[model samples]
Target: MKRTTLALLGLVSLAACAQAPQGAAADAAGSQAATAQAPAPAPKAAPRPDTPEGRALAALRELDPNIEPDRLRAAPIPGFREAIVSGQTLYVSDDGRYVFIPGVNGALFDIRQQKNLSEASLASLRRELLQEIPKSERIVFAPPDPKYTVTVFTDVECGYCRKLHQEIAEYNRQGIAIEYLAFPRMGLGSEDYRKMVAVWCAPDRRRALTDAKNDRPVPVRECKTTVNQQYALGQRVGLTGTPMILAPDGTQLGGYVPPRQLRERLDKLAQGGAGAGAP
Candidate 1:
């Protein structure tokens, strides 16, 4: 989802093609073979304190107590070092005097390749983090043979979210599995949050979600639920609206796409083409 053994080509070529005197050539070949087979030296460790990377790691630790400094490394940007903490990337200056958080303006695009490097990295991170979510916590509508899957952050009261839900069958038919994660736009303790909890706690969660999205009452019997956790995850991933679709690779598709168009886009992505349709 994300290297092969290296053959000693030079040694092999020399052995195959060289025609030197017998004993000397054999001795030389043996020496060369031994050298080639020897394990490569281990990489040198980063220098200790007083070094730029060291200072950056120290500063990052102060800023985020949970950061694992071992993960920090010099970034392509000359003065900045990058680290991933809780699936989000952070950049700190070599001198430990400046810190940068990725944002809309910070999203670097490779115009030649027509790709958003920042978004791609973030998407991969999101996928890694989201993989921890148990299937039991989601309301999933999957086809018999789903070719692609999408995780949608949805709110019961959001009109577009409801529209997406209404077409859930169509999405499934298109071989696109839909996994719903509750995102109560209204904060915790609000009616929307409570309703989402009710839906999540329902014995038949898929049906409950469908009914709730249709504005029908779901039995308000709350038990243990991950609705709040899902909302928090949505926030962590920078979700600002309901019906936000996350493709299988964690690419955020932003908003709703018509079923056929969504399927076509998924196909293109599967074929190694860039993501189609706006976010």
Candidate 2:
């Protein structure tokens, strides 16, 4: 959930914040202040296209076309959508005049709201695009001519991710080819980030990655790598942790799923049985 302030900030009425003048002077000042009327709120901003509301909505539509204007309504903030395009509740200004998109982490915002609406947006966006899959990033890790491929957004240092790595053979035994993409999780500054870049860019990425996962020492060589792109992909999908599974068809399964379950679900997705779980 995001809370946006729609009211014009500079136009706050004086009646809301006058302090007492203190003592006898304070008494007289209070009486004078009380007699003075507060200024009226400023006229709403001109809507663009039609008025402020239209402009604000146009801006939102620029983000995506699925926005239903009829579905648009006054938010707690007034002008913003009572809920944004993704059904994520957001606040808009009261006058259908202005809009703000708030940033939040956990439960600290003024409004109490469920988390990951932003994450959900990323998933929705991915669903609408990112359809063609790439091959260079994939490696056949399984037997019997693998029937499923899973794109894993992984960080080498992540614990559960390490656990998943340990089971790569098991997953393959079930005919799931594990394709890996780097999501360093610590951003690009960390050592793991650099190493993963070397792994992805290595002449034999499969060997480099497998060796790295098995704790084998690899000569670190770096070129411009897909590490950044992969991390961006992960973030755009709201990946807060590692070992995110992107099924062959792009449905996302976060965290760790056991090999048996992973194989079954992969088969299901391959057969067109999964929903839009991608992010």
> In order, what lDDT does every prediction score?
0.74, 0.59
Q: Looking at model 1, report the run of 10 residues with the lowest lDDT sum.
A: 1-10
TM-score of each: 0.62, 0.52
User: Model 1 scores what on Cα lDDT?
Assistant: 0.74
- lDDT tens string, model 1, 37-90? 889877546558798878776665554344454367789888888866544566
Measured by C-alpha RMSD in angstroms, how accurate is candidate 1?
A: 20.3
Candidate 1 residue-wise lDDT at 85: 55
Candidate 2 lDDT, 206-273, residue by residue in tens: 78877777778778896866577777777775566788887644457557888888876666556544
Off by over 4 Å in 1: 1-106
Model 2 clash tally, residue pairs: 14
